[model samples]
Target: MAPALSDILRITSSLLVLMLLMFCMGAINLEAQVGNLAPDEVEALLEVATQLGKRGWNRNMKLCNNTKLPLKPDADNEVVCNCSFPGGTCHVVAIYLKRQDLNGSLPKAIEKLPHLKHLDLWANYLSGNIPPEWANTTLELLSIGVNRLTGKIPGYLGRITTLRSLNIQNNMFSGTVPPELGGLVNLENLTLSANYLTGELPQALTNLNGLKELRLSSNNFTGRIPDFIQRWKQLDTLEIQSGGFTGPIPSSISVLTSLTDLKISNLLGDGSDFPNLESIAGIKYLYLTWNMFTGPIPDWINERDARYGIDLSYNNFTSEAKYRETLNLFKSTWGGNYSKPVEFLIVCSE
Candidate 1:
């Protein structure tokens, strides 16, 4: 009682069709579970994936497995995206590509990530000028330090109102700092050291009243140190070295009550000329090396807080021994009547 050959083929075909229909239904259910990400955002992310290399983002993996979203799954530990929101919509909030040994130009399409808050590409081989389109975004932190980037800093960067910290140090940027930078009213830290930047520091920089730290050393900037620096009342550290700044240190510097560390060296001025440091009581570390400052060391320097330390090395000071005496005198205050031996460093060399 074996089944006929034609009947067997018909039964087999029906079973196969049923299995196919079940598979399709399961796929549809899976798709429904994965939440929706904006179409434009998906396209922008794909562009990044293509530019950075497809290996960094895998299409086969679940992007938002935890939340079941349509976001691209993390791949090769290179890219990261955030998709947790009220409406199941995802946003690429941060991109950290630091020290990835990445080489090539930064894609201008990066500006397309509207929700991007932090972008770090430090210690890479990235080159070329910063994209002006970046100014149109809402980035909060942009760090591209220790790279091979060149060309003048784009003025459009000033238009980015959301920026809080901008680090572009150790690059090949040339020309004067863009005056437009003053527009970053909320900037906290601005590092532009170790570059070929030149010309007078734009007076507009005084507008950054909220600035905390400013490092502009190892550049070719010339002209007198701007007196407007006193306006940066919140500054804790001010480092300006190896530049061709001339003229006397401004007396207004004493007005910076919040200053803790002041390093200004290798400038064009008489060795005797120094800033008025009497009012800056918070200063703990003062470095003024390799300057032409000659003349008697100010007695007020020793009168500073007992914890204050200074490096006046390789200067044309009147006498090293006298400077040592000043520091030792302050150290004595710590010991009181016992007058215990104390170590004070007053670096002075021929």
Candidate 2:
């Protein structure tokens, strides 16, 4: 009968190529068990550890005080918090156990932990905030810094723009400062220091221009410090202390030649001095102490260059002998003959 109909069409084409190679090996073993811990993610992590062991939660202490809980990553049933190795310098790649202290809230099945990145629950006493579906995933590092986090810092976190590092510093984050965080242009490190952040200063954070480190100190920020803040030319550290900055400090900020550390101390109050700060000739650690600076302590503060460490003690400097001749010319050109003051700390002790 025509050779049994060509052997039943070559045995139905070899059982359809062995059922398409067993459906591509079961779709690559469900994409390598999608980083394991399945079974409805361990039944939603034992139903969030049976609702935090029914409140008396203490699955082995260490909840704060440099917090610990991350250490496990062999895959399988997941739940291996943080397994560091000599490899990727691991920081919670899969199950960080989101905003720990499993009290209440946040368990909408945890959006099914699709390889969480790092969700440190800042000062957690975790309450309700930031759960708009967690802006839909793909986190790198999101600290709820000093929690009690009220609303408004989450404009969907600008969609987690490949966040490098972000800390919602000392939370209770009030309105503003979310100029969409400049869409996290690969943020290097940012902390909205002491929140309650107000308007201005968030022109999308000068578009983050790849900030190196910026902390908008003790917020309530007003305007006029933005000449694009010298475009953060790889800025090393610039803290705008107790914001409400009026004007005049921008002598183009000495073109920010990789600012070492400059803190414009306690804004416009007690003798605020910013008269071009001797052009910060590569400031080493200047903190223009308590503001409202008036005149005389700036003949370049006796022409500083003594590897710099000027504090300009409590402003309105009437030059106590020109601040003791600029601390004896920074203890004689940064080395000191006055009982070894090589690293000066002139507080004017007032």
Candidate 3:
């Protein structure tokens, strides 16, 4: 019993419609998965807000759409966004919650922010070590200093090659600076001061050829300052006050012709004459205190009128008269106990 032609045609039409409907549904699912700002990331943001004590944002509110909403930010709380997707979806790009006294563990959910580049939580009360999940982002500036964070700085941070400025000073980070950090070829400014870090500077750090400024003051490090610092040809400012290192300034440091500011205080071992700074044509500030330096103070200190300020107090210089003749110890606090980052642009002189 063959079915009638019209019935067969009708059945085929229904089946084709059903198939088309299924295909459309699958396409919609794929779009939701790959196109818009990911749902998981939004959820991650909510988790971050919850952990960070930010109670303003909610899930139903669109992050990018509600840009004009008054969120009553305090203590530099901010959440930057970018919304140029085909369907107007958005992405979190940066989160600056500095000076907020946020007392919580750094959430692992930060890895979900695919477009995030900056995450500055400096001067917070946050505790605990940095989560390994943070390494998954493309961060450029990661400043978390002046916090109560503890534990060893993970070597995985070196994997964040995009980092330009990394300031983890004034924390309780222990252990040695990871040698793997040499992988950050683009890193420019690095501050690891006021930590409980020990051990000599890793020789692998010579690979930071692009380094601009480096601060390692107030640490419990040992051994002589490595001569490998000559590799930092682009270095502008170098600070090493009370770093628990002994011996003279590496003579090779004179090769850093780009240096504008130089600081090395509280050396426990032997010291030599003023470093050869004739190559540094534009030297500005110099802080060389509490060291066992010998010999006469360089007369060139006055020769460079462009020199902004110079501090050579409490050193064992042989020529007491000359040391006093050409010195200005009036720029900063005692022992280089800087509570925050310094501004090098504005030079202070006597």
Candidate 4:
């Protein structure tokens, strides 16, 4: 009787082990499928396609199949998926539909793509303001530049704390920048250039200590260039040419040791000394044109590999013997004005 009982127990144990192995294999197979696309995501995608005026998306095939919906260069409609969810559920992680000329509104259904991190709609003719429903998303990068997006940028955008890059340039967005944008502490690139935006920059912008590039040119803004820019210790590029800002370029700029390209011009303020850019050895391109900077030419401009990298045109720099000597031939063309109303424009870097 004891031998019979032992045999039955061993048999039962073996069956249990076999069952466990089969379950694991099933799990592995599901994982290998890159997580089956979730039903809600598919529905949301359908809505997205409808809103974007794209008629070619086939609902029958797996959306996660990269061969069918690629995320490569120049691909008109791209959807990237992340399949790391529990139970092998896949979710859309990114969407890029650039240069499509899709005459559609910003899709409110985009909020349903919950896991989406990046959304780019560049070079499109999309109309209307950003949908408020988008504030609920956790997007990291949002690029809608070179589009026909119109209306004031919504204040609700600040609620998206996960954002790292917010580009809305080359649009028809008017009105002052909402102070709420200052809430994006993780922001690295903020491009509001080439818009009809006006009003003073909010003091709240000082909170973006991690900002690297800020371009706010060709706008209708009216205010002093804020001094709080020194707070951005990681800054590399800053462009505000014809940005409608007044006052001297803040001397505190010297504290930004990481500056590489600094372009600021058209200040509506009194004459000031040259901004101290000596500490920034990695400086590549410097453009400070159409201002009233009255002083002797600083060596920092000449210190780089800049045979033609600095554009100090229409300023009031008294003298730089070396620069004058290099451009001595061009001087004869300018009739030796010496640029008390200094005029300069350097060719773009090679």
Candidate 5:
């Protein structure tokens, strides 16, 4: 086989070229499979990690792994980023740092987590305004309630169309209700209770037709209850207590046939005849106390199927007989057993 040196050289040259081509193709495939995280996203998360006291987060720790990270004890617990690996790249899906006693402003860098769906920083000591950068997030549940946060509710939050539940209650946020919130067409549960927020309920809120539970209690909101509230046919639980509303209960509320729990106490107003509630069969809890209502109690209230209870105290109803009749109606309807107590506190001296 030791025939021609030129033939052997040609064959070797062809084999080398083929090997080089194969190596290049393999390198491209590997690059596509194990690509690194986006540089901007990494930078944003690193800023958040640094601002939030680092906790269990470290620059050297793997951001995503096939095995879930173990949750450490309170003092040692990290940011708890739940990540998913798709196409060999790690993507954070949720960040749960609830009750961590975290003390700092929310990092604007949070917008970097494009795949983040749930961000629960509940019961933290985080203060300052919510970062307007959050408007760009595709978050489904944004619960930052029970914090020390202050400043006006950001109007930009309304741009988050994918948001389902937004709980910013128990804070110090103040100012008018942002009309921009009406843009959250997918919102179901909105809790802004126990805050220092003032101003009338925005008319733009009518756009949230899909809302289920709305709590605006313990604020300083003034003005009449909006008539458009009837549009929320899906609403089940509604609480607007301790506001400065100075008008009659809207007759349109009767359209809330799905309503089960309702509280509108300590406002300034007379009651409507509430003609719409006459046929509502699912009502469970009805509270209308500490108001200035000065008419005969509506007879239809006795017709309610309040299996839980009813509270109608501290109002200025004119007749004591009307109160007795109301109590008698409840006793008769519930078979006199009174498994659930009904409150009918009449201020006799007033």
Candidate 6:
């Protein structure tokens, strides 16, 4: 009454094929799910990326490997690759790994994401050189400061014209600053202090039309301050201390009307030739210590009153009552405005 033994074998084989078909179909469905995940699914993926762990990268072969999309799909089934936050997509536009236990070099896979804009990996244990591919990407802000990165800074980074801030201070970067950095026209803030950079300050940096803060202190840089820096109208703070700088500070720097804090010391030359102090302008806290400036204190401090606080201590300035100037003075502006001079103190010992 039942099916013959031979027929049973055939039926069993057919059933096996059906099972395989279902397995293959399920795999396809999972793959397609990545491209069709709902809004909530994308948020989960972003959360995973944030937890990249002490290595700061997910290196597992199947790790979120195409199992998820950057953003939720539209009604038309098209998935978005990159969109800012609040759009509710899985797209990883920026990575904030500050003060994390993150270690090791950045993954080369980072360059594959064409829309990456911000990268903050400060205060991490990250070591090794930044990948050269970083130069080709479109980063708006790169903060790798306070890391253990070594090797010459990628000169190619100068090619990134869209960058607004570049902070790589407190690293082991050596060699001269890349003059090629002149190409970054949109640069607003650059902090390369406390490195091993040498050579003269590049005059080409004047080309950075939008530069506002330029810090190159505590390095091995030699030669005089670049006079062309006066062209950077937006520059507010200019610090160049504890270096091998020789020659007088350029008088033209006074033209940077926006300057607020200016420090120029440890010079190998005289500071008197740094222009008649009276001509200098701006609300500046000036420090000209530990130099061979031989002359009387310039009358500028006497003229500008409060806003032009200065520190010429330990220099060769001829002033009898140098200690008397330490007293703060409240001077009245012409418009019945009373302003006090915030005395800037400079201490140097032999």
lDDT digits (tens) for residues 246-300 of candidate 2 = 6456667777777777777666433334467555466667775556566556566
Sliding window of 10 residues with minimal summed lDDT for model 2:
328-337
Which 10 consecutive residues of model 1 have the lowest summed lDDT?
329-338
Judge candidate 3 against the unseen true structure and give its global Cα lDDT, from 0 to 1.
0.77
Residue pairs with backbone atoms closer than 3 Å in model 1 (clashes): 63-73, 271-292, 271-293, 271-294, 272-293, 272-294
Q: Is candidate 1 or candidate 2 better by lDDT?
A: 1
Candidate 6 local lDDT, 1-350, one digit each (tens)? 98999999999999999999999999876555444223443443344345334432333222222322323312111223332234233354555557766666654455655555667677776778878777787988788888788898777888888889898988889998888888899899998988899998677787898888888878988778777887898888777778677858777876777877777768876445435445446655777655656554555565555544566545554442223354232221212212334454544210
TM-score per candidate, in order?
Answer: 0.75, 0.34, 0.78, 0.82, 0.73, 0.68
Which candidate do you rate higher for TM-score, 1 or 3? Answer: 3
lDDT (CA) for every model shown? 0.73, 0.59, 0.77, 0.80, 0.72, 0.64
Q: Write the per-residue lDDT of candidate 1 for residues 1-350, one digit (tens) a residue.
A: 99999999999999999999999999876555444655676677667656544335444444433232222423213344555565656566667667777677766778888877777777878888898778889988888888899999889999987888899999999999999999999999898988899999998898899999888888988888899988999999888878667756677888899998888878886544656787888888787766666665677776676566776655655533334422443321211221333355644210
Model 4, TM vs. native: 0.82
RMSD of 3: 13.0
Model 2 / residue 222 / CA error / Å? 14
Can you rank all candidates by TM-score, best first?
4, 3, 1, 5, 6, 2
Superposed on all Cα atoms, model 6 deviates from the true structure by an RMSD in Å of 15.0
Q: In model 5, what is the error at residue 16, expressed in angstroms?
A: 45
**Top-scoring candidate (lDDT):** 4
lDDT of 1 at 181: 97
Winner on lDDT between 3 and 5 is: 3
Q: Which residue pairs overlap in candidate 6's backbone?
A: 70-91
The CA lDDT at 93 in model 3 is 72
